[model samples]
Target: SEPFLPFTAQKLVELFGLEAPDWTQAGNGQLLKESSSIGQMGLLFEKIEDEVVEKQLNKLQESKKMNEAANAPAVPMKEIITYDDFAKLDMRVVTVLEAEKMPKSKKLIKLKVDTGLGHRTVLSGVAEHFEPEFLVGKQVTMLINLAPRKMMGIDSEGMILMAEDKDGKLKLLTPHEGTASGSTIS
Candidate 1:
């Protein structure tokens, strides 16, 4: 009778047409000499299986780390600034007179806002999250003192203040009560 071997060893021996080892002389180590080929093949398969398992575990651990990082805060708090620096910012309430998507731009919207001081042309990157029609007539906060900058060949007079939610959606910052356009935000 042949020595009992693992299923994998038996399959390997049958697949490769190898002779079965005698089990009667296992105490005398005759089985070891006769079954060396099957034992080696079994060991190779076990090593390959172990390596595959290790690679899968590594992939799962990497995915878990990425998920944790994604769940962390999107932005950290900035350094504290002096009251004078804060006062330097001329933040005002502005009413959107007109809004339209910028030409050849996917994220920019051109806005004509009434700052109470005068009408100002402002470019904001909110087209992806908001429609031009939705912004029209909406009252929102703005920083009016920023030096005018050219975007897409047009001058942008001010920056609109917006807040981002946990889901990464952007929302306009508006006064709780109706306020006159150009009114300073303290």
Candidate 2:
């Protein structure tokens, strides 16, 4: 048999010992349960271990496991900072009174937060992760002392903190229990 070309559809079918789809039977929907294209691809992938030589198959399986492990979520710690630097940030708990998408901005969501400091406007780039309706009434950690900046023409007074996953999902940092609005974090 001839060597298979890398990543080719024929090679994939051969590598997996899967029956190649009969293109003529595609529209008839008789080949597989899934949509015709996906059904055939799934069947091909399913037979991979069977088609590949035992030693090479074992190596491929190991490589796949390593790749999956490499994709696991991990965040590298930031460079160490002095206590004085840490102490300078006025981090506090704040309650979200309202969240609204900023006009003309794809990523910005303007939030009305109640920090014991007062009801302040904060702009966050989390529109992709959160809906305006979902943010209301959530208590979150914020850096209340950050200098005001204009975003989407609105004055953003603080920043909300969030934990980000490797795949770019963000989870806002909220206290484990109810805390008063504007409670100091440290």
Candidate 3:
């Protein structure tokens, strides 16, 4: 009786209670899982409330989101310019007649464009953004009156208008859908 007074696994199995000792297992007086190994200390964390767990999970997700956002690309700085300098250039929407990659250059691409005025050859640093088949039919804005520049041994007649995004991706300046082949942008 004296030995059984204290509740041990053997004494509890023999105790006369409404519930059977074998039906329910109590923690073995340690914060360890029952089947713990000798060298390993297996401790059970208290069951947190569902709301608390959910909140912690959300916080981890938000922290990851912030880190990903912080690692994003930088946006280029904008410059201030006079309207007179801006208005001096003539920009027109022109259709590409032909597009082909340059012979010896990776960044340069040759483009034949119809500017309503005439068909002109324009070279662009746009080999990365455009495919020859896709570019041939796109009506895009261009600096129609730029001084000719030689690229890869070819005289480029004009420059195409392209916008650079924050991620450093170049996008062509295209008119609204159904726009004609040649139109004045100004």
**Top TM-score hit:** 2
All models: lDDT? 0.86, 0.82, 0.76
Sort by TM-score, best first. Answer: 2, 1, 3
lDDT value, residue 20 of candidate 2: 62
| Candidate 2 local distance difference test against the native | 0.82
Tell me the TM-score of each prediction against the true structure: 0.61, 0.62, 0.59
lDDT of 1 by residue, 120-178 (tens): 99999999999999999999999999999999899999899999865678999999988
lDDT per residue, candidate 3, 1-186, as tens digits?
224443443343333221343323443344344664444323323467999999999999998877776787676567987899889989888999899998887887899999988899998998887777889888989998899988767899999989886446788789877466567777
Residues 27-86, candidate 2: write the lDDT tens digits.
Answer: 563444443343233443344565477889789999987787678867677999999999
Which candidate number has the best lDDT? 1
Ranking by lDDT: 1, 2, 3
Error of 3 at 142 (Å): 0.2
Model 3 residue runs over 4 Å out of place are 1-79
Error of 3 at 106 (Å): 0.9
